[model samples]
Target: MVDLLKPYLDLRDAEVETDFGIDDPVVYGSRAAIESIFTNLIVNSLRAFAQDYSSGRLESAEVCFRKIIIRTKKLGDRVIITFSDSGPGIREISIDDIWIVGRSTTPKGSGLGLCIVRDTVEDMGGAIRAEAHGELGGAEFTIELPLRN
Candidate 1:
């Protein structure tokens, strides 16, 4: 997925860092849905960073202005995955509101991606949450799912 989206990332000088703690943690879910989740999160961060860059919020002096990190770890019975970025954080509204259908912060976004993300996670018997200011100083999404498929 990262390779497929490399052009956009390169265009905006964005970098992606992946941290997979387990060698090959297994989770059984719809392949397409899983890919969609990752894609949506990355794209949303990219869009947010684009806005920041366009508005001159990201200056030459700023460090780590557009980094997206995907980290995964395995617990006794669950797998935890976090996707974060160094762009602007979310709004004052609760993180839950960001998953509402047709709700969007971007100017040209239709707002369907996040809504689908929430639904897909719930359908897979997983739990997902968002933090406005995470380890990356921007928005973060953490998903927890059963280790055994």
Candidate 2:
């Protein structure tokens, strides 16, 4: 997942930190499906940073400190993966609407990223949620998937 998002992260000048808490954590899903889910989430974070930068929400000095943290943990028979960023967060009123197709908070967005993410997660028998307040002060996406037997 990190490799797939390297270019975008480099382009956005964003810092990424990853922590895999468990050894060889495995989930019940295809590689492509998992990749797609993470790709969309990372892309969305990058987009949020870009938008914030363009709107002057992030100053020049703070640009270098832009952070995105990806953490994975094993919770019993489930795996929890979290993607958190330091970019602008989703509005409280819009959090529930984020997964709706054609509903975008940014002008340049197609509004389908989260929609697809939710669909793919459900297809894999997993669940996903968005949190308005993240440790990084931006949007946080938590995905829970059943561990592969």
Candidate 3:
């Protein structure tokens, strides 16, 4: 995942930290589809940081503090993965709209990113949700997938 997002992370000078709570976490799903879900989430996070930077919410000097964290844990028969960032968190009112097919907070966004993510997750029998103020102080996406036995 880091390799796939290196370009965007480098472009924004963002820091990404990954943690796996378990020795190995396995999920029952298509590899490509699962990759796509995380790809969109990370891209969206980078864009959020960019928006905050341009709007002066993130000062030029503080740009180095921009960060994203991805963590995974296994609970019983499920695997929970979370992706969070240090940017302006989502507003309560905008949370519902985020999953809509044609809604976007970014200017050049197609608005289909999260929609595709949700669809792909559901198709794989997984569930996903968003949090306004995650540990990272920005949007947090939590995905739960069944463990592959």
Candidate number with greatest TM-score: 2
lDDT of 1 by residue, 1-149 (tens): 67778898888789999998976666768778788899899999999888776678677667446899999998878889899999888864577778987677777777798888888888878889999889988899999877764
**Stronger candidate by TM-score (1 vs 2):** 2
Sorted on TM-score, best first, the list reads: 2, 3, 1
TM-score each candidate: 0.89, 0.94, 0.93
Residue 129 of model 3 has an lDDT of 95
> Which residue runs of candidate 2 sit more than 4 Å off their true CA positions?
none
Q: In model 2, what lDDT does residue 137 have? A: 94
Residues 1-149 of candidate 3 have per-residue lDDT tens digits of: 67887987888889899997976666777779878998999889888888888887667898777899999998889899999999887863488898987788776777899999999989888999999889989999999988888
TM-score of 1: 0.89
Q: Look at candidate 3 and tell me the lDDT of residue 43.
A: 86
What are the C-alpha RMSDs, in order, of all predicted structures?
1.9, 1.3, 1.5
Query: Which regions of candidate 3 fall more than 4 Å away from where they truly are?
Result: none
Better of 2 and 3 by TM-score: 2
lDDT of 3 at 140: 93
Worst 10 residues of 2 by lDDT: 87-96
